[model samples]
Target: MRAVSLVPSLTEAIARSAPGAVAGATDWCTHPPDLDVVRVGGTKNPDTGRILSLAPDLVIANEEENRAPDLEALREAGAEVLVTEVRDVPQAFRELDRVLDACGVPSHPRWLDEAEDVWSSLPPPATRRTAVVPVWRRPWMVLGRDTFAGDVLARLGVGHVYATHPDRYPRIPLEELRAAAPDVVVLPDEPYRFTADDGPEAFRGLPCALVSGRHLTWYGPSLAEAPRVLGRALRAARP
Candidate 1:
């Protein structure tokens, strides 16, 4: 089946679940880099004409990925669109099932079961201090309470002092970094890449670790591998 994936998170799942079946994907679909697949552009402004020309049997889009115009165009072209939206872990599983169903692949309930089991089995993170940079510079955003990243940190035995905040991403006064007094500041490398060379001068006097943002945020079958990688990094960087 010729399918086009426009979401980055689902791109990974589609690549793992369907392998070489993805005929067209977005530029951000680097989880399984499409060295040969057609590019429909990107999540926000996917080339509707290019995707339409491919004449795909199925098109996988996400509420968060495709803009209304492109989505409308796909529908106008009479493409069978399977839209997926994920917020929490359970919703992620439900969306995965839908994608699998779209691809005509057998639903792998065991994988979801295993992921939930692994997630539940994780010892809640300790009260050790930690700070996650959700966005870089400009407004200076941070992960607040109830976000997927916050949940991951909570499970890793790390404390998120900002867990009381309402928004998933909250704009913070840059000076608050000093006030938080976190033992370790984690600068993630995606959505806004924060690197070691970049230095934690802004967080001067605070311990810091640049982390893989994908592992901290993206949850899916990849979590099976990510938890271990993130856990090790967190442990090694422990103060």
Candidate 2:
């Protein structure tokens, strides 16, 4: 089955599970760096015309990572697109299995099984901390309300202060963020490349953990190692 994965994590999972099943992928789907496929553009703004040209049997996308109009456009063009929504760990696993199966994977792949095992077997958190997780700078958009990332962090004993906010991703003034005074400031490497030197300085007193965006955000194979990796980062940032 020729599939076009619009999400980076899905692309990686598909590529790893089935050698050459993906016929097209977004430019940002860079996991298997050597994955040679037709570049379909970015997740938010994929080139529907180019995508349709490949004549993919299936197109995989995420509710959050992809735009509705683009997916609809693909559907209008006669491409069968499977959009997956992953609001939490359980949802992510279920969607992954469904997506893989739809892409012709006869059964659950080893990586997927390992990923499930890791999350299911995680021990109690060593410590819990309240954090202000920032995804972007400039205007300072943060993880708020019911987000997959928030659920992931909750599982790891780190809770973001904005989880109760009205908006999923609210643009708050930097001053307001500093005023919140969370125990730690969790910064991810994607959406905005927050490095140790770049994002930490803004939160002077708050311990900042620069975590891998793929582990913290993406909901595919990375989920297997996300617990350990993100847990270590959160632990290290404890003040």
Across residues 1-239, which tens digit of lDDT does each residue of candidate 2 receive? 99999999999999988889999999999888899999999999999999999989999998899999999999998999999998899999999889888988898888899999999998888888788999998889999998999999998888899999999999999999999999899999998999978888888888889899999989888988998899788778833
What range of 10 consecutive residues in model 1 has the weakest lDDT sum? Answer: 125-134
TM-score of 1: 0.84
Give the Å shift of residue 55 in candidate 2: 0.6
Instruction: Report the lDDT tens digits of candidate 1 across residue range 1-239.
Output: 78888877666776777777788888877775543688889789889889988888888887754787788889998988888766555566677888877886776745566777787677755555566554576768887766667767666767666777887678888788668888677778877878766636677777776788777776556666567877777665532
Give residue 159's lDDT in candidate 1 (0 to 100): 65
Shift of residue 176 alpha carbon in model 2, Å = 1.4
Best by TM-score: 2
The CA lDDT of each predicted structure is 0.73, 0.91
State each candidate's clash count.
Answer: 3, 0
Clashing pairs in 1: 125-157, 125-158, 126-157
